[model samples]
Target: MHDSSVFLIEFGAIILGLGLLGRLAGRLRFSPIPLYLLAGLAFGEGGLYPLGTSEEFVAIGAEIGVVLLLLMLGLEYTASDLVSNLKTQYPAGLVDAALNALPGAAMALLLGWGPVAAVVLAGVTWISSSGVIAKVLGDLGRLGNRETPVILSILVLEDLSMAVYLPIITALLAGVGLAAGSLTLAVALGVAGLVLLIAVRYGRHISRFVSSDDSEKLLLVVLGLTLLVAGIAQKLQVSAAVGAFLVGIALSGEVAEGAHHLLAPLRDLFAAVFFVFFGLHTDPSSIPPVLLPALALAFVTTLTKIATGYWAAKRAGISARGRWRAGGTLVARGEFSIVIAGLAVTAGIEPSLGPLATAYVLILVILGPLTARYTEPLARRLTRRPRPEQPLAPPAQATPVDDQDTVGRT
Candidate 1:
């Protein structure tokens, strides 16, 4: 068969699988992410068909997906919203990061992986899928409720932390077995910091130009800025997603409504390609032995997130039920985890660990939405009943009706 023919056949199969499996996932009340992974597994190296493309292409597609995802995330918030919600959001964010990372790191070490790998794994698992959580809450009609803002804020902070976390971990992984000078680290940090500043400072200005009456101009400018920042971040050894996210964040406030209008279609189009390519790259043969261990890790990671998030919410004076809901809602890890694992692989990490990482992602992507769905009822069950109302006093007499009666008597 011709290479083109083979490629076309694989591509067609992937599309068919995604459409079929997506519906199946919805019917089963599962998240689409897992379905995408399943589709990938079915059509990948071990499956009935293989596209035989280079991993580089898959990676590129995934990278584009991350950028668009982040861009959409940024479009959801304004700078003001971020500042206002920081108090409630920051604590939960910290707790989420710590709980996931600490245990993950320990598990990796116990599994004979080194500190760097463990740390990277921990960092990766720390992020909850904001997209999944938001959708769940929205479906439950909880968008404007008290917990909504808090959860949203935490997700935003997580996104920011990840932007910084990626480069640091990447550098650490790259510098393994060698001394990384302070100069190199400083340069990386400085470059990232400067880029962030420019994005935020100039974002509003760029937004005004893009939000003008012309749709084509709006799209061109936005795409241009996105690509430019992505390029700069890559050149500086930082993940382009980080740059893309910052640009989105900067434009977030100014372009809140307009950005959405322009980018929504683009986001969906690119995101589809990203997921399709992601599925195309999986090597299913690598999954079996690591499956059980991956499941165990997923269980542990989810439980820890619940516990920590509950405690954090409780500390913030949330009701017991609210705490439970928060915990459950925060359980699912997503894109960030995969990115971290990919970085590990690039750093010459052990091949055995790769399957474990993929399995963990696959499991969470499948279970995250299901877990999120049940959070509300569970929260209600665990919350305390409302206190009884106090009795009211009897009504007081009006000036004995004295004056009116006396005047009317005549």
Candidate 2:
């Protein structure tokens, strides 16, 4: 009874704290992610106070948080959209990877963290925060902007690439033999391909099968199926988040919309927990030692992400203003960065990696909204040249000879 009471108290406090943080963020017109992380830090290993009973529960919720985050992201588009984006926007995706990823990998190598950490850090810098970006778009009312589709396409490609990237990273971190790793990669790819194919071809049927007039039944069915698929994927050495995303892609139409509405609150709640859980595992003192590196990395990657967005928007023929907006919008790195770093930290790849990631994400997540709002205006202000004033042209003199010119014809 005492333990149960303690668990209830701790969990209640967490939820209430999250609620207050969310409200504060809402009032401040910003994402609650950073505040959530700060809260986690305060209650974590090296923070002001740590919890005992509820930590386990928070861990489980954090995992689900990741799964739901990817799943909902997948639900935002159809497989046809994914295929089309892959065909057309792939170059932008490649450029994004090359430009943003190299900095983190180079930093890792320069720090002598070895090849594995370099790869992990590369992933950390490569993917932008889809969740944060989505929120920024909605908040700033930029969802209807010309550059938005270009931004979405780039995000889709990044997420799809994860189906391949996550498996390879998993295998690498495990230090499995080449043959075994290849087998793992093959299986992951095969499953992902099959899911995408089905989503494209028979998505309607899948949606119909899952759909119901009753919201209660619909919620239960969708939630259960997602968790099941995510679990199976994890067991198969693929990312559970990928599995959940595929499941999301397989459902479309009203069913997808309904599921999105039903699951949104849950997604927000657990996602906050996920960020907090990430902070829970990092030592506070460690963050300061790596703050300089994190800031340096944040600065470099911020520029790279802006460049990537600008390039992609320009390729799509967006106006200069829209291109700048697109570039600014992609500057934030939130959930996915931490997700990649969490994997590396779990593998015990580097001691400083987690703290650095935490600090780096904190900086970007806060700076993200500000940049999204100001980048274009700032760019225009700085690069805009003053137009020279043209002297007013003298009024044309009245043609006194007009009558004489007409008289000859008359």
TM-score of each: 0.82, 0.94
User: Can you give the lDDT of residue 375 in candidate 1?
Assistant: 63
Residue-wise lDDT of candidate 2 within 117-180, one digit each (tens)?
9999999989998888988999987777778888888889998888898888888888889998
Task: Give the best candidate by TM-score.
Answer: 2
> Once superposed on the true structure, which residue ranges of model 2 sit more than 4 Å away at CA?
393-410
The total of clashing pairs for model 2 equals: 0
lDDT of each: 0.68, 0.90
Residues 86-187, candidate 1: write the lDDT tens digits.
545677777777778887788788888888878787876788877667766766665654445556666787877766687777667767333443444465
Model 1's C-alpha root-mean-square deviation from the true structure amounts to: 8.9
